[model samples]
Target: MFLVESKGGAIACMLFSLLFLGTWPAVLAFLERRGRLPQHTYLDYSITNLLAAVIIALTLGQMGDDKPGMPNFITQLYQDNWPSVLFAMVGGVVLSIGNLSTQYAWALVGLSVVEVVSASITVVIGTTLNYFLDDKINKAYILFPGVACFLIAVILGSLVHSSNASDNKKKLSHLSSGYEDKVVYISLLFLSWNKGASKDPENGKEVKVPAQFGTAEYLIELEDKRSIKVFDRSIWLGLAITFFSGICFSLFSPAFNLATNDQFHLLKKGVPHLVVYTAFFYFSVCCFVVAIVLNITFLYHPILNLPKSSIKAYIADSKGRGWALLAGLLCGFGNGLQFMGGQAAGYAAADAVQALPLVSTFWAVLLFGEYRKSSRRTYILLVSMLLMFVVAVAFLERRGRLPQHTYLDYSITNLLAAVIIALTLGQMGDAKPGMPNFLTQLHQDNWPCVLFAMVGGVVLSIGNLSTQYAWALVGLSVVEVVGSSITVVIGTTLNYFLDDKINKADNLFPGVACFLIAVILGSLVHSSNASDNKKKLSYLSSGFEDKAGKIAFDSNKGASVDPEKGRQTKEVAQFGTAEYLIELENKRSIKVLDKGIWLGLTITFFSGICFSMFSPAFNLATNDQFHLLQKGIPHLMVYTAFFYFSACCFVVAIVLNIIFLYYPILNLPKSSFKAYLADSEGRGWALLAGFLCGFGNGLQFMGGQAAGYAAADAVQALPLVSTFWAILLFGEYRKSSRRTYVLLVSMLLMFIVAVGILMASSGHRK
Candidate 1:
């Protein structure tokens, strides 16, 4: 049977397993949150989960020439390996139960906390057992410390959940009477008081309203829609189930370890230990069987007071079946990879993936909105929990390999990561010795091409600078849509001609037209949203003026108020509704003028023009289609051009930013170089962002050189990604008019179609 004998191959399997396993939980949770019945989801998931194992066994387990001792999957099925098979089955049974329990726990304790508790328990208990089972193949000193980190994460996770639950309870208690009647009015309040009340001017008495999601309204909606009713449920039940699931999770890995290695020598002396594939097949088979029986039974006799369902009901439920099946596939493949890695590097080391709460927390925040506007204490604990998992994974991963590396080894790690990803996706092949050839060409003569590369960098820097102001003026969604559409329309056309029509014009020009349509729709959406914001601001301003006048009249009549109460009212009033918009405006570096829309559109147009020119200039530098080079001088290579381009971009950014620091414009506060250096907030994040951008550009240019720059301009669909973030991160378009929402979605759809068409237009350079 095929085997992963090398440490590197095993580590690769482990890393992929971590990603896949970490993501499946989020998918399942997503379905549950959307009100899909757990029984139906689980039943659907079981089919694909078992199918994954069968596919793996048929492919990887039958690929290599089978030896006498290491029989292939089919051969092993008929052999006397029942003892090991039973052990594998037991592991699968426990895992199925553990997963089933966690589904309910997610609704109770929250996705992020449930994952943290369960994964920590798995690592702490499972790793300890696997270390002894695997004969201490993994380093105890490193592995034990990583386990300790998981334990800390468990404590912090519990604390975060407890604190957040308290915050929710407090918010619910303070909810105003008759809030249900005024639901529409209450919804308009932006950041409102979570723990107290504001004065009602008419009655001269305190009144309260819901601000964020953990309110009575939200809970009632969830109870009405969700299969697992959390209404009036005790948090202790969820915590108890979480602990039980963790214990179940802890035993499965060690059971699988014994099944593969026969650590207890349960088999006969002559019987070969089951291979990873055969053992995994038996494990998944039992898992599937257990899941089927339990989920089917639950359909007839549901738990947690969930609504009764039957086989007919499950068969009829097709709303989220595709997502459930996908989750199963992801989990099955993830488990297979984990086992393969464990067989090579010891099951104890493979337990490192139990730190997957890091991935779970990311999805919980991004997809589920788990921690939006959470308390400071909860955020702190959550951050600490994630950091501990990171350290734990690092220690466990380090334990799997022998330590030996030079400076060059450390330096090339990032480059190697990029190359590995490209190779995996079939975007790259065997490397060529192009660096020396480019160096030789540089010595001969390429001064004019170097100038072309530098000019591209200069324009790119200006474009980047202009975007900061444009975002404040035109908004993130509109700016990205307009800018990216302009890039594709102008840049793609330019590259098509420069590359000698290598790209199919028929397909390319249609994509450009789609982008043009998107631009128009985007402008309409922006104008509609602006009008909505103006109405909100006008109402807010008039209301505040009326309240101030009332307070002054009361003061003149010798009325008095508590100083603390006045301060509390001021604090609460600063959030929610038009106050949110005012706060955002206050925080921005560039102040928006009354005529800023026109100015913003001008800057956006200029930025798009600059962005469109950079790629064509780089194309000229690499391809030299304009023949701006001396005789016998070769054109600049992709890497050489990128180097000069990024260098000039960096230099220009540094000079311009320093100038802006001392002499700021557009009503931005002025600061000196010393002040910039002393500012420490978000410095690490800024540096990381710069590195990612540079790496992305480098990859884009490399791919462009290989294929054609016109097709490479497909990356101009930046609005698709930016719009997703704008909706999630900044709450853009939330509670906007229906017409605005339609325009927004239509603009995104056009961009998607445009991107696909542009990619389809790619043609071979030769």
Candidate 2:
């Protein structure tokens, strides 16, 4: 609490930074529905490293080094207007906390009124307190208007809530109910199936009700296939908390700015500008890293526990205006604002007093309507929050506390923000409303995935720290606005392509419009001068081809052989040569594939081959390259490009996994991670695929990490390895198709490319 004051709302501003940062966390929640798979869980989120950084920065910003250093933004804000800034920031934090506290009321009450009630209550109390605390009575109009706004918010929330309830009740008459609400529809089905068993007299006839047009048998026999998949409230609560925390996180930019600006102002002058900027920059990096990673894991929490394939809705319902689009806009602008503010000012302030549940809860209630009885509470909360936020703006303005208008000058930037926000909104709407995103798929029942997810969580913590810097550098809205926009726009486009049905819709008004827009956007992006510059930058492309030719030649005939002249072809190769072998020219020169690509792939491929062949190649190449044999570098280095690729795969895998995770949560049967193993139907031979995958990964890990360059050079003997493995192991050849053969040839070409890049970089005497 004291730190909040010291930080001058930077911590509060983090609410926004953390908000957009929550996409991954939401995804994690969707994942829990899928069973059998070890959940993608990360422990890093529990730790708030950026929050710690904020505390430190806030405290340090306040006290200064005391000797003589200070950041100018802080000094500027503090020296010119300490009182205005302090009071305004304090007001923001308090108001934001008020908004954050009753955030869930949107679901409990109604969107319109939840904010009103919360805000009215808060403002009323705040006004009363202001009479004594600030030595000024609140303006009657502002105070009364807040109350009225709260009332209006309440009325709207109630109306919308009740209307929704009626619709739900009617719908519920035909659907399955969970533990909370019991429905007798399914049992009736069994009863109606029986003919003339009880009520019918000696004839195969159906019983009937007086008012019912259909027979009693028909009433019970209605073939309703609707069911509801429910989530554990405990899990939901956790997800909600994370969501709330994200809203609170959004305010960090403005809040911190208010806190640190004053401190920087008061400082005398020993602090270097670099130190000031660096403090915020490092803070941002840490915050962002944490936020990014935690976001991923948090999203997995729900789907990991859900019944498979339950999130999909069996619907004849009309599609309404996309709410996800709104969320994306919020995320993008929110992030962009933080970066802008933090960059411009020495501090970033965050406070989410009015942002809670607004975007997300809106979707939860309207789209799914799962909260049940809280319809009233949700209304109240929404009403109060709205009123409070509105009053907050007015009150803030009345106090004349605007951060000396920094956003107006740049039209291009603002336009960029708008388009990004719009594009993102559609994307967010298309997201799988369930949890346990693709990243969690990378996690197996074993420890590798667990370890990676855990490490990922740590990275998330660090990223959250980066957000603080984003705020200090840019502004709160900038980060969310820009980042969310990017995510949403891309996601929306992908969603179009991801679903065939959705793509079909592209022929309509908004759909066609979206497609054309995308095309134009693509053109803008591609037609830019940068595209040409990118082509000109390809001077090394052809050189790689020639080098590939050489490697292919050596591997084909053996001229690239070692000069030791001792025994016959020794398997023990040297490190330099191993690295060199990968780069040698071949039948297919390095011209197209290039060295870097081959090196990455080679490690990705037969890394295990390298491990076993390590000692064999030891004599062929230089000791300097295979130096790992003496030490433990072998074990450590192997995980490099291999695992990073896993992270990349998670990005796509989450998409498929979400489908698997969602269908189960929606109570759809046959939804499972095993589905990921299959092609179209559930026909993928798991044992075989697993072995192939495992073999592929193990080789990469052991060979890349453990083998010296010389030992790795042993891979130059692909022909020998291929021949032996091909002939000896029936398993390897059993699945070999024409495609596989083609791919192998490509790999051969790539190997040569790798050698050439190395050679070119080496500057040969020739």
Candidate 3:
């Protein structure tokens, strides 16, 4: 009986400790993100004291009649399961990468209602994915609440500070300063994905909260009257609500555990069925509780009220919008796994110790590293989809005859979750003070950070390559730990080494050293690559040995030849010992394994081009619009401002499409005569992409040339419409599910409606 009672409690408490431990790092970061946790001090003492309290309570519960009965779980001294142990540790490491909150706030809610509207878009994405995958869902989710969430995210993303009649439009302060209204939305919008983690522990655990930071913002203001601060009552309220909700969700986890058990398993036929009693009463209450909170915290939303003219003006000035969007997506990817996984685990634990995982965002964040967070959403979605697919695989381990619709169900769930996770991760990346543009330019100003970042990226690449190799030989944990170690080392290096003084001279050493040290590092990287190739060879040999009579793998040494009856064995190892050693056994780890390295290079190169082009355009538009009091036509400033705003959105999209098409470094054009057409296969398509932009630009330039400044939009519209059509015609986007496609079409319809209102009002001429 004692052993039975203690079975799940220990796991539950460990999870609770994570959330409890997590809040400290967060608050510590909230206070001074740069500094390490103070050691051997009062803060440390407090943490220790809290940890003791929880352990004591758990200890007492586990003890038998004044003595602990060896605490039900036999803490194995890593006895027989070394591989599983390694995997678990790696899982913990990957989960620890998430950590951006401040920057995400601005992307969510700008100064204007339009930006507030844009911020609301994530919710649309989140809810859309949820609607499809969630077993218990409603119609209102799609038509009513779903549309509302998207409109809000968009309005928020688009909202920007407008210049007053007598002044130039100030760049809205990116960081919070004397911005109450916007900050309110920032905190709230941030809460949309990052509701943080659970504040309290579960039934079997004790939580140590930090002095209940309730309304601390107000208290701080009262304590220091002279201080004009970003944290105030509203911010405090938002924080309190966020943390409190975490507590509520924590309570839901154990209940869900019971529900999961009940859902999957069949109980015995007895007088009082164990499952009937346990599930019926508890599940109903849990559902009701979840429903209430979901509606109040997530579903219930503010009404949108965009001025018809402002919406039109936004359409006109959609120039700088691409960065904002890409930023939003990256931020979403970073956030989704941390926030959604946190919230889900909180509810899934059903008031047990497992609920503690939510406290520490790092655990979840690390799994979706900052770099991965910043990559293209499609890749992020693909990674997420792969993970969900793994989960579906685990689901297959259930002790029963599988259901008929198992594959379909798993596929849909994986796709939906992947979409939601991507959107969330993208949001987190866009929210941060991203890798400074100066760093990747290989410039003097940010060279230190950039240099270290690139080195870190290299380390990451090596680790990923190693991980793929390791996974083939071992399991998932190999990649997880090695990859985690690389990130930690790089992030720490960046934090400590990167400063203002790094210059061309400092960087020159590395550039020169790289050449001098090429053999050593190259030996390391290339050697690993070669060894992996060798291992891949040997893996094939082993396969050939085991299936000696059954199959043949003679490929004439790297020559592609299809043998009879084994046509689909392109992934087969060749007829050699080296071939059998490195054949791809763990396909999942290696599938998108090179994503980190590839994206690092892509982001580095593509961002430079995108920024260089867009910056000049943005500057031109800003100068043309704001300086128009004396320059062009009388009301040109007003007309130009709106055009530039709309350009922001469109330009970002165009840049993304361009980047997607030109991702592989080899795909870039060759400059000289011989090289020019040498890269034709790559350049030909690039030319078409460029031509699409050229045609769009030509129409835009011509419209501005022919029509008076105010009416030039008719010409600009040609590019946007064409671009939209091009996206449809090109098979660039994934084949979306019918439901998702429909939802997107509906969004398009709403955008058209919004565009119509804007175009009609454009004729009014402000």
Candidate 4:
């Protein structure tokens, strides 16, 4: 009654299979993030994957002597069919490209969507290919339908939870920023049309247009076409890449199986383990070679070869080196396990393992913070999708072993069940009236919050843009460090230097130091290796809230309408606003440094210095020695300053959106201006967000006026306010891994200490 043949064994294998495969994809995500940072490239990924395969091959190569008839794994590989090895290598090349594209998909779409799509594709293709090609396990009836059902579920799930466009803004924003220098060729006819409109005479009765019968209407039509093309291209590119990657994933197992099958004489019929290890080795070699060629070609033919300095910088980047090595090991080992598992447990066990999208979806939600607070329809869709995967595994494993029922009968039954479930879920999830769209949530009440946010946006726009420009001039890490330090030190000093002479608390500097240290630690946590208790860990967090201070915190819960929950008023009680949380998450990650970082740092340092001046500038406009704004506006000083700032933010947002419409950085779709204006689903929320943001900004200014800017900013480090809300209201940290909890607690404690220091430093009250 081994686990492979027994029901219990199958279950155990499925769970273990998730560990062997589910978590490894996340490492690739980390590598992709490195691609976005300084001194990293696909070459690094290639090198790392090769190294991991080598390590595993070498390790497994040591073990084949256990079998009496076999030579070592390496010897067997050379002794096997040369064509088989070559084909395996070719398969590896396809896989490597696919793997790279998988990361790209993750970056472009998200973990959950890509996981479902790719896993579904792999199951269908791999199951069918291996079943017919390999003698390892044979069950066409159960396998085909199960895989089909899985595919259907994936489609339904995708439709249910369409890409959260707003959620992806941060990741996609960089594309626009990176491509800021790239130019788009536009038709001159539109320009001519605009010019004619501008030059219309006072009589305005007759402005002759071109003989082609062009007019304002024609311009509008042409503009719409251009916007739709850009928008559609971005969407199509992402979908195409995702599809290609899925097909590539499907080929890996079949290729490896073909390489090692003794019947095919693809490789030597050595010890089973030795064969598996050899297959991996051949695959890695191919991956490495292909990666090198592709990357080199990219640098040379497509884009001019990067300067030697950039290449050197990439090579010299030691920071991501460790992560890359770790990723390679995980990936190589994971593949090896799949091969071994296929050999040991049979096709049922292997197919069950292939159904890993469930595990991936769980991790995507918990670790990456996706799908939180999604609509009920999304929840149902996700559940339905998971159930379909379960059905797929159930039938896929019973393939050749059915005693009473025919394969066709089981397949039809399973297909029907999947269709019924998917339909039920889809019908259940119809977009109800009150769905959270985020674009149309504006209300009269939200205006104040929107106003507040716009004010904050205005107050911070110059500093923010300067920060972005500085990153291009220098690099991100340097700018962050310099900006953070200056914002703390200079802003605090200016607040203290104010004419009111506010009492200074003693913990100001210490608090700032502690928070900065914490920020560094939190960055490390994201990049840190997981603890050894990896198998026992569920990828999902337990969605439970601590009730200790629930009653006390409940009072602060604003009667805000829940976007995901529909138009119903829901309590969103928390100290931190959404803006604060977004900003906090955005600023958390820290990258490894390179030579380019120095220039970026220098620019960032100057920018940071300028950033320090903004808070003081607001302070001055409100109530200063010059009273340049305060005296004139008197009671409306705060409002006037905020009004100006909001206007700035509005202008910048509009200009940026307009620019993106023509030249999309992230390759996102561009809608016509009419479409944008017509879409009013979440305007209330937008205004509310803006208003709340403004309040936060005004409060910052007021706090700086009362305490030193250093003290006020130090208090900003107490991000736990938002964390608590994310937990209680959003159930964010439920049942997370111990390491995750440790990271969370560490971040929380650091922020607390920083806050304590800031609080202690704010000596006397106003």
The numbered model that scores best in TM-score is 1
* Runs off by more than 4 Å, candidate 3: 1-251, 259-528, 535-766
Q: Worst 10-residue stretch by lDDT in candidate 3?
A: 161-170
Per-candidate TM-score against the hidden true structure: 0.53, 0.28, 0.23, 0.41
- Candidate 3 per-residue lDDT over residues 177-223, each given as its tens digit: 44444445345433322333344545644342321221223222222
For model 1, what is the error of residue 662's alpha carbon versus the real structure, in angstroms, after optimal superposition? 45
Point out where model 2 deviates above 4 Å: 1-144, 151-163, 174-417, 422-766
Tens-digit lDDT track of model 1 for 277-396: 999999999999999999989998999888899999899999999999999999999999999988987898878767567667767876677867667887888877776666666564
Clashes of each: 3, 248, 106, 40
Better of 2 and 3 by lDDT: 2
Writing each residue's lDDT as its tens digit, candidate 4 over 722-757 gives 444345433343443677667656756766776676
lDDT of 3: 0.27
lDDT of 4 at 16: 48
Q: Of the pair 2 and 4, which is ahead by lDDT?
A: 4
Q: Which structure is stronger by lDDT: 1 or 3?
A: 1
